[model samples]
Target: MQKTPKKDKEVINVIIQEYQKNDLPWYIGYSGGKDSSSMLKLVFNALKRIEYFHKPITVLYCDTGVENPIVTTYVYETFEKLKKECKQLNIPLLFTILKPKLEDRFFVKVIGRGYPTPTNIFRWCTDKLRINPVKELIDKDVKAVILLGVRSSESEQRDRTISKHKTDNEYYLKQSGSSSNIIFSPIINHALEDVWLTLRYNELPKSIDFNQIRMIYKDAESECPVYRESKGSSCGNSRFGCWTCTVVRKDKSMGNMIENGYSELKELFEFRNWIAEFRDNIKYRCSYRRNGAKGLGPITLEGRKIILDKLLKTEQLSGLNLIPQEEINRIYELWEIDEINVNYQEKRLTTTCIKHG
Candidate 1:
């Protein structure tokens, strides 16, 4: 561990002071990524320092269901460890895992509803899969201040957005629509190097093993599946997200993992690339948009069925429950509806031909 900087200490102190001053419930958005993990460590250390800290701190994690298998395991294990630690320390820390509704699941959308895999321009996955579930939880507490690990140094666009909405004292105010909720980006000013330094030098809770993150990523910078409402940009080159994400043109992160001896992920990487390739092929798409316009629409019924069959085969090979039973049931229901509609159209055409003859 390296030496802790004075500025880092001051940032932690400010977080403590802010927590002490407010009776408003605090919700920390934890994504099991480097930034969120660092934020959580700082918050835990701060709580330990406060002599009579009894305020409840809620940690929210959004699970997209399609996340890398290794990441899913890490998240579950870390949360369980944190809960045990909190119990021993008598800290009021609650960790909750948020998940998308059954109907909104990745397989359900792609196979049941025939929605195409998300792309850079038509990326519809984020809002339904990542944002809404977490937002529903946050909305429950009207006075909640969301703690984020977003650093301005991450991107130029992010920096400009942060500077635009920040308060005089540096607290970032949530934009117009979400005016009820405030954002506390404690590490906004911290550089990328500062972030890693703080994570290394600080005494983190036993529940968190920062080294695990380093081992998994192997020099790749990663972020949890936090939904950014701003149309800033996609996780193009970033190594952390749903394995099926096609917004980046290439999943460099997963490719790197496979090259780094995670051979188990090779099948998933292949499936992901296959889906991306299929998505670009006009043969797999419908003739019209859902709104009746002549544009790219959901995958055709035949396309959906073929993809579903392939995905199930992949699931068997990987020995992972990629699609749940509920989603399978829903897909059958959708297929039945499509079948009935097609039958009705055929019968109508037959009757019309007989009358004309």
Candidate 2:
């Protein structure tokens, strides 16, 4: 099936020219998500069919420490399968993983430092998880060209976002800080239907399963963690962010996955729902947060109705186990940090009082 879009043929040609270049490192970024999957198929097919594309193409996937179980599995399987397949075809398949240092996961910050679950305005999650990981992948090659499967038609906001980066010549090519670091989005012009059409006609490897995750997006359920410019509800769902995301109360993607017979993962969803309900409970949330609500600026991002007592209750009720010893240990460390700071302030006050007296 010639899913090569008619309008985007020129973009493909340019991408092909870039690939044909002798010196540049072609690092195609894959998220194991649909958009990236389509990009993978296109680039893989293009490379496989043409001798010039046979040059080394690094298929980089950044594992954001916390991804959907299915997504994680898919990524690993896809990387391995692609590598073997490339070996058979004599093409070098390069896969890279970019995860944050130990201090960047949900537990380290949320359970450790008492930072609340990220809100829309302050999405501390994305820079650590999504953007940072992608940057790491790009940083691998000295003269790297990062191929992303970002399409203009994905969203109005996405279209506008990509437009700003457009140079007169390239559709989705942008310069990174280094002259060697270049990002390319070849499928920027392809339509959604075109992507699906390509998938429907071609048989993806048994290692890759798109059928399972399709339901998350099947019903117009989109809650993107990425900052959206629109006031209306976010137009992307089944995203692979925190499971404890309290931002979107009704997570259509999680709901879809659960309702679709992922019974094993049902408890996590239930736990998330309970956390959202109990978020406002003052009893569970500390009255005086570690920073005392004042230090964290005017807005008190200090409270979460997930106290130790409530967590015990939640564990009993859900029959779910939180990470043992870790959260408790983290809370204790933070409390100590807070206590030391409080004591220093007290000592300063006492000296000042004595000085005045």
Task: Please tell me which predicted candidate would have the highest lDDT against the true structure.
Answer: 1
Q: Model 2's lDDT to the true fold?
A: 0.55
lDDT of 2 by residue, 1-357 (tens): 454455444554666676776667777666666666766766655555466444577776655544555556667876787777777875555667666644666545665555555555545666665555566655666666667776778776666656665666555445534455555777777687766554444443434445643543454322232211212323223344456666665766666777877654576677667656654554333334443342232111233224445555655665645445655676667545544552223232221101110
Segments in model 1 whose C-alpha atoms lie over 4 Å from true places: 1-4, 222-237, 342-357
Indicate the worst ten consecutive residues by lDDT in candidate 2.
Answer: 348-357
Off by over 4 Å in 2: 1-14, 52-55, 140-143, 175-180, 203-240, 277-357
lDDT (tens digit, per residue) of candidate 1 on 44-102: 87887788775798998888889888788899999999999989987778999999998
Best by TM-score: 1
Alpha carbon deviation, residue 243, candidate 2 (Å): 2.2
Candidate 2 clashing pairs, residues 3+ apart or interchain: 222-236, 222-237, 223-236
What is each predicted model's overall lDDT from 0 to 1?
A: 0.76, 0.55
